[model samples]
Target: MISIRRFPIRIALCFLVSFPLWGCASIAQWAAPEKKATTSAPVEFVNAEQEFWTHFHAGHYDRIPQLLETYKRLYVLHPDHPVIAARIGFLHVWHLSERMRMGEPKASVIDDATLCRKFFGEASQLDPKDPRFKGFYAACIMAEADIHQREADTRKGYYLMKDAISDWPEFNLFTGGYVMSQLPWEGSLFDEALEWQWKTLDLCAQTKVDRKQPEYPAYATQDFSGAKRACGNSAIAPHNFEGFFLNMGDMLVKKGEVPVAKKIYSFARLSPSYQQWPYRNMLEDRIRKAEENLPYFRIQKREEISSKNPHLMFHSEAACMACHRTND
Candidate 1:
C-alpha cells in the first residue's frame, strides 16, 4: 500500500530493501514437465550431459562434480554451442551460491565469487551478441560487489547493472536485482524500486514468454535440461517473483513504513509464486508482526486516575483499532 504519510527520512526517493538469498528463477521459464529426468540416460551421452540438471534441481550437488566434467567435455566438443558455455558459467555461480547457502565463510564466498565472475565473463564472450549472457555476466560480477571488490569497482558494477537493465527492461530479474543493488547507494532508487517492482509484477503476470529466437544446435533433445528447456518453448509458463515483494516489504520495514510493508506482504502472500519461496509460509506471520508494530496502540493504566490513587493509562483509540479487523 502506497501511503500518503511522508517521512523526514528517506521515503519515496530512497529505500533499500535487504533480504539476502540467491536468485533462483531461470532467465526465462524454469520448469520443464514433459521430460521426466532419470538418473541414468538411456543414451549414454545425453544421459551424461543432462544428468546435472536432475541433480541440480533435486538438490543433489554431490553429483555436480561428475556433471561438471561431462559439461566440460561437451563444451570442448562443441565449442560453438552457446548453451554449453552458458551452463558452465551458470554452474560456477550456482556452486558459489550453494556454498553461501550453507553458511560458508565470507572468505570462501569471496573466493568462489571470483571464480564465478571469470566463468560468466567467458560466457558473455562465448555469446557476445546475447543480452542474456551479458546480463548473467554482470549479475555474477555483482555478487562480488562490496564483498571482494573495492568501492570504486563496486560502483562500476552498479552502473554495469544499470546498463543491463537498459539492455533489457523486459527482463525483471535484472531489473529487480539492479534495484536491490541501488537501494543502498541511492535513496532515489526508492521510486525506481517501486517502478521496477510494479513492472515486474506485470511481467510476471503475463502468461507468455517471448524468447523470440532458439538455436536448434543449442538444444539437446535427448535431455531436456539446463538453459535449453528453461527457455526453449515460449509457451512454458512464467514464474512469479514473490521475493520481489518480500524485498520491497523489507525495505519499507527498515524505513519504519509499516503500512506500506503490510500492503506489500499482503500482496506477496496472495501470489502463487509465494508458495515456492522459503519465506512464503512465513509471510503472513511477518504481516501480522508488522501490523502489531504499527504506532500508537492502546495503553491502559490506573495509576494516576484523577488523583484518586489509581493507575493512569491512555490509548490512541484510532491508532489501536487502525490495523485490527477482528470484532473483538
Candidate 2:
C-alpha cells in the first residue's frame, strides 16, 4: 500500500540510507514515553477584555483569526457581556477593512458584514447608553447596503448615523462624518461631513483655540484628559489626532481651498505621534504640494489611482489600522 517510488529525491535518499533502523527507533520512542523532565502548572485564565486590549495594542492584526476564536468561545460562557460582543464586532470590521485594502473581491465581504452587523447590533442593544456601539452598528448597516445594493437600508443607516451624532456629538461626529465621507465630494452630504469635522475639532478643544492660525502645534501639547476617548490620543488609538487633521486637510483641498488645506494639514504635524506615524510622509507631501495634489484628493478621480494606494482618509490605515497597528 505504501508508495516510496513517488517520494522526493531527499525522501528517497532518507529511505535508502536510514529507513528500517530509523522507523524502528521512531516506533520504539513513540511506544516508550515514561520519563518526565518536570511538572508544569496550568496557565491562569486572564480577563477577556484585558487580553483583547493587550493583543490589540501590540498591533497583532495577523492574529485576528485566533483572537476571534478565543472571543467566540468566551462569548458562549458570558452571553451578556457587551464588551465581548463589541470586541467581536470590531474584529470583524477590522478584518473587513484589511480585505478592502488588499483589493479583495466584493463577494468576500458578505460574511464579515453579516457578522459585523449582528454583533454590533447586539452590543448596541446590550449597552444602550454607549452610543459608540450603536454608531458602529449603523455603519455595518451601511456596509451591508453597499454589499447588497439595498436603497432603504442606505437611508436607514444614514438616519441612524445622524441620530448617533446627535446623541454623542464629539465621538459620533468623527465616526458618522467618516461614514459620510465616502460620498462624492461635490454633494451636500460631503459638505455636511466637512462641517462635522470642524465641529469635532471645536469639541476636542475644551478651551478656545484659534482655528485660523497658520500653525497650531500646541495641539500636540494640549490636555486631552477631559475629552472623549475617541477625541483624544490613547494607547487604543495612538494616531486619532493626526489622522483627523489629515482627513480635514484633504477635504479642504478637494474643495479647492489649497491655502486653508495646507494650514489644516499642518495640524497633523503638531501631534506627538507624527514621528511614529508611518504615513507622516504622505501628510508632509500633501502639505507641500497642496495645489498640485488637489485633483488626486478628489473622490471622482480616485479611480485613476491603484486600489492598493492609501490615498484618502477612508481608504488609508487612518480608518482602522493606524489605531491598532504599529507598522503597516
Candidate 3:
C-alpha cells in the first residue's frame, strides 16, 4: 500500500497558477491533517520484526542468532511479506559479512560471504526491483570479493566487485570498483583504481544532490545518512573521529607529514575502538619515535637565536672563551 500521487493537467495548472498566493497557507492546512492522521494511529509491526529492531539498536550482536531464528519462524507464518524477508536478509549481511560485532568463541558459523549470497539472493528473487534488495545484493557481492581476496583468488574478487558496481550503481558501487581495481597486481592496478575512485567520487557527489530532491525514495534517505557521514561532512572528520585515523595517519607518514601524522596516530593509539586493530601497535611505536625526535627536528634555528643576540660571539669556542674570561 504505497502512496502514489497523480494530478490531472487542469488541476495541476490551477495549482501552479495559485501556488504563489496560496502555497504556504495550503501547506500549513495540509500539514495539520497529516499530523493528526500520523498521531491517531499506533505504530505496530510483527512481534518478530519489533524484536529484531530492538536487539539491533541495543547492539546485542551476540543474541542475533536467536533473534534471527525467531524471525524465521515468523517468516514461515507470513511467506508473502516481502518487507520481513528483506529485513531478515539485510540483518544476515549486517551480522555475517559486516561483522558488526565480534564472533563468539567456538561458534561454528557460516562465513559472511556465503550467508550474504544466500540471503540477498532470496530477497532479490522475492522482490525484484526493490531498491533495498538491490543494495543488499551489491553488499553481498562486495563481501564475496573480500572472501576471495582472503582465499588468494584476486581475479575472482576483482570481477565480482566489477559486477557489483554495474548492478548497483546508486549504492556507491564505484567504491567496490575502486577496490577491485586496486588489487595487488604488481603496481599495474594504480591507474584502474584511480579511474574508479574518480568515478565513485563523481557519482557520490551527484547522488548527494539528488537525495536532497523531494521525490527521492525513503530507503535512499536512510542509506544516504551513513554514506553522508562517511563522505560528505567535514565537521565530523571521519579519519579523526572514527577507527580510520590510524590508517590515514600511516598514509600521511608515508607522504612525509611526520609531526602532524604522529599526533593523529598517537590519538588513534588511545582510541578504545581501535585497540584491536592490527596497526595499533605500529602507530604507537611511530608516535613514540616521533615524540622522542621532536626536540631535535623542531628546535629553533641557530640563525634565529643568533639574530636575537646582536653582540654574541659567532663561534662556539669564542663564545665559551668570552663567558669564561671573567673580566680579564
List the candidates' TM-scores in order. 0.54, 0.75, 0.42
Off by over 4 Å in 3: 1-45, 98-107, 138-170, 174-198, 206-328
lDDT of 3 by residue, 1-328 (tens): 3234544666778888888669788788877732110112113335666776555544455666787677666566555556656666756655553231242212233465566666666666666555446555654665565545454444544564555556555333433432332133224453364345335434544543221121212222222344444322222222222233333333333334566556545544333334334334444655666544333322234333222221111111121111111111
CA lDDT scores, all candidates in order:
0.46, 0.73, 0.44
Who is ahead in TM-score, 1 or 2?
2
The full ranking of all candidates by lDDT, starting with the best, is 2, 1, 3
Worst 10 residues of 1 by lDDT: 311-320
Candidate 1 lDDT, 20-139, residue by residue in tens: 112233422455333221223234456754565555544454455677687778766665556666767766655554442343223454665665566666666655666666776666
- Candidate 1 local distance difference test against the native: 0.46
Query: What does the lDDT read for residue 79 in candidate 3?
Result: 50
Q: What is the number of residue pairs that collide in model 1?
A: 12
After superposition, candidate 2 runs with Cα above 4 Å error:
1-47, 100-106, 206-220, 227-229, 289-293, 299-305, 308-310, 326-328
What are the root-mean-square deviations of the candidates from the true structure over C-alphas?
A: 21.5, 17.5, 24.5
